[model samples]
Target: MEVHTVSETPPDRPPQSGLVRALKVPRNAVIGIGFGIALAVVAYLARVLELLGPFAGTREYPVLGPEGWFLVLAFVLATSTALLVASVLTVVEIVRLARTVDE
Candidate 1:
């Protein structure tokens, strides 16, 4: 029979906290992806209702511009930006935690 004793010393690099660990979710981006989805729906309905039809000539209200294409793009970009920023922050936080542990 062999008896092995593990060392009590702390790890060189500690594991990150649960909050920091949660940021690893790809789809869990902190951005407004859901909000973007809703905006897309609204833009679709606006186009269908021809709400922007009147602006076709005057090119008024960016929302009504180019058949509301701009609005769709804006909403999607906005959501992506938000999510991107959130994900970045999460990554930074995790990195910071890792740095602390390494120290």
Candidate 2:
């Protein structure tokens, strides 16, 4: 009589390290990015409405006007900068997570 043996491996599972275990891809990054965008929008709106920072008024500073042109410029610059920084940070985090996961 001949007998055969079976060899099998267990199923994979997610790590459990408290808060670190709860970390997820894309979703967390998207949330962070969305928060950054919202922050930028609020900042821009507050600046336009003269509700942000100390220097809040309707007076010309250098070249742009206070109501339209100045508000638009401020919004553009603030939003762009915020989005750019958020995006870079998100990318970096994703890369780091990927590296760790690979290891």
Candidate 3:
């Protein structure tokens, strides 16, 4: 029988926790699929609400104007970028997990 104890000393291969664990999700392809999906969903909603680029100028439209479009685009881009990066990290984590020696 063998027992492994948790200690402050890091393992030769560090154990994952928190966000690291989240990134290790095996399902993500890490090719920006989630980012693309989320962006599409958001864009669809914005268009449906008549809140896209055409209405982005707040001063011109007083509602859903240029500012609105800029805000929406900025938000969508930022969120998609973050998700894409996270997805890539998840891919790396999955690969690392695959290579780890299992007890």
Candidate 4:
């Protein structure tokens, strides 16, 4: 013979543990990583095409030669892009968390 208001209602699910919360990643970060991987694949394909072209092995880069230099550059590009995207999304998530906490 009791009635409960919304404020007194029990939660549907139990609270998450600290470790579980910490391990969770925001959706934006996952999307950013996916985009980064796609970009890396494109970069690798481009390198392969360039190396297979008519000028293959004809020219040399400064330190590592054409093949090595291209590989390094592609790696740099992929890493930087992924880091940049993940950082931006992380910042956005932090801001969102702050707003919710303030409420």
Candidate 5:
């Protein structure tokens, strides 16, 4: 006579619901925003340190100088980067979710 042995591995979990997966979009956006901000800060610092080059544009106003322009550019760059990254991640997540559901 032969005896059967039991396995200890846990069963695989069911795929997450679409809504649950979708909820991660906001988290992805936040991650993108953080990355963008970090990138902008680094770029700004490099420009300020003359690593890029000396500021040549004439200052139109005393308060808003080249530094201020850099800040403005950084803001735009960060915002755009955030949007792009968020959208891309969202699409990728959706596709993955769809594949999993189909399977």
Candidate 6:
């Protein structure tokens, strides 16, 4: 039987591959993504408000006519899609980073 004690195990910080190091995300990129997500949320709220607020009282969404509503919906979809993509990328990057650790 073999038992690996904590003291015997390698440190959590391990050498990273050249490709991984090259691809490592910068802090600014993460912050940018967060800001993007926040922007998306704000847009979503604005869209909902427009739909349910004063604009909605005019001739069944006159402010946002059929075409205009379509555009807003598209914006919402785009933001949500961006959020999803960012989240997935972040998770994948985290996993990749974790794999580099000795633990």
TM-score of 6: 0.42
Rank order by TM-score, top first?
5, 4, 6, 1, 3, 2
Worst-scoring 10-residue span by lDDT in model 2: 17-26
Estimate the overall C-alpha local distance difference test score of candidate 1.
0.63
Number of clashes in every candidate structure? Answer: 1, 0, 8, 0, 0, 0
Worst 10 residues of 5 by lDDT: 14-23
Q: All models: lDDT?
A: 0.63, 0.62, 0.63, 0.70, 0.83, 0.62
| lDDT of candidate 2 over 1-103, digit per residue (tens) | 9998766975677656533433443455566566666766676677667685666354656666555665676557656765676567656666887899899
Q: Give the backbone clash total of model 3.
A: 8
Best by TM-score: 5
lDDT of 3: 0.63
What is the Cα-based lDDT of residue 24 in candidate 6?
Answer: 52
Q: By lDDT, who's the top model here?
A: 5
lDDT of 1 at 14: 56
Stretches > 4 Å off in candidate 4: 1-33, 50-59, 62-64
Deviation (Å) of 9 in candidate 1: 33
Q: Assess every candidate by TM-score.
A: 0.40, 0.39, 0.39, 0.54, 0.69, 0.42
Per-residue error (Å), model 3, residue 39: 14
* Model with the higher lDDT, candidate 3 or 6: 3
For model 1, what is the alpha-carbon lDDT of residue 98?
Answer: 86
Give the poorly placed runs of model 1, Cα more than 4 Å off: 1-17, 20-67
Tens digit per residue, CA lDDT, model 1, 1-103? 9999999998687566655456554444534465556666676666657676743555455546564666667577667765766677667767877898899
If the candidates were sorted by their lDDT against the true structure, best first, what order would they fall in? 5, 4, 1, 3, 2, 6
Q: Candidate 6 regions off by >4 Å?
A: 1-61
Candidate 5 lDDT over 1-103, as tens digits, reads 9999887997788776656557577788898999899889988898878787886875574678778888898999899988888888888888987899899
Better of 4 and 6 by TM-score: 4
